[model samples]
Target: MSEQMIEIQTKLYLYDLANLAKEHGFKADDNWEFSMANNAERISIQKNYFPTNVTKIVPEILLQVLNSVRTALKQSLAVKDAPDAQSIIADELNYLVAFNPKRPRT
Candidate 1:
């Protein structure tokens, strides 16, 4: 949970990474219906995709999760105390979304 360890250089660039993922989502036609779906519905349409411009909705979904956590903490009374929580969840989520398992870094 050490945010600095996840940091690139000294920029604390997790935000930049988040922003890039957001841009990718937007470019990928994130506004479409198929972009949002339930379990069965999603599996059904995995092959047939429209607005093929939308090649990266899954990342958008991860971004939404980060935003949702941010929103949750914003409304809470202890927002200042838990600043790193949102970033950590976002990082954990990116790890999960990107299928990055808990492997030792070389």
Candidate 2:
């Protein structure tokens, strides 16, 4: 039996959408459409095309990911005030500091 194909959609913020376009080398006239709602823009992805084709550059993408992490951590810490979360965040920060991609390799 032949498998059926399904379509799906997802959304991203303008900043992230720009990065995605840049990473994919999409031209200015590329076929894309967007809509604005709740003070954010949204796009309809036809399928799971992004994950198969895109890879995240650390410098370009890490800041956004870290911002989200810190925001969530802030909210969680406010609600729970857990020492473990504080320690985990500290350790992660230190690890990021120690991770120098430009350092000479032995």
Candidate 3:
């Protein structure tokens, strides 16, 4: 894959991971705070969000999700009756939507 495609894929994976984390009641913040006390002086520290147990599991889940997506894309592309790009996207969206926790099942 080209560099741009890899970048896009990484962004998508991170976006999905963030949404998944939020759904699980984890905070998705751009900034995280820490504190230090030394020699009777208080020090304030700020950095990006720290990884929790949930964040640690994200990589494994993301890899599985990406693998599934890749398999689906390959299968869709290999069909003798080729599906259009829109159809492929719609199918994938429907697959994802099926997992919505708030959606009422028929």
Q: Which stretches of candidate 1 lie over 4 Å from their true place?
A: 1-34, 50-63, 66-106
lDDT rank, highest first? 3, 1, 2
User: What is the per-residue lDDT of model 3 for residues 1-106, given as tens digits with 9 covering 90 to 100?
Assistant: 3545544554564566456557655543332111111212211111222231121112213333433444533322133543344554433321111122232233
How do all the candidates rank in terms of TM-score, highest first?
Answer: 3, 2, 1
Quote each prediction's TM-score: 0.19, 0.24, 0.27
With a 3 Å backbone cut-off (N, CA, C), the pairs that clash in candidate 2 are none
TM-score of 3: 0.27
For each of the candidates, the C-alpha root-mean-square deviation to the true structure, in angstroms, is 13.6, 18.3, 18.2
For candidate 1, write residues 51-75 as lDDT tens digits: 1212222332333443343343242
Residue-level lDDT of model 2, residues 19-105, one tens digit each, is 655776666554332211111111112221241112122232323333343343232213233224345444332111111122223
Regions of candidate 2 where Cα sits further than 4 Å from its true position: 1-12, 35-106
How close to the true structure is residue 72 of candidate 2, measured as C-alpha lDDT? 35
lDDT of 3: 0.32
Residue 42, model 1: Cα distance from true site in angstroms:
0.8
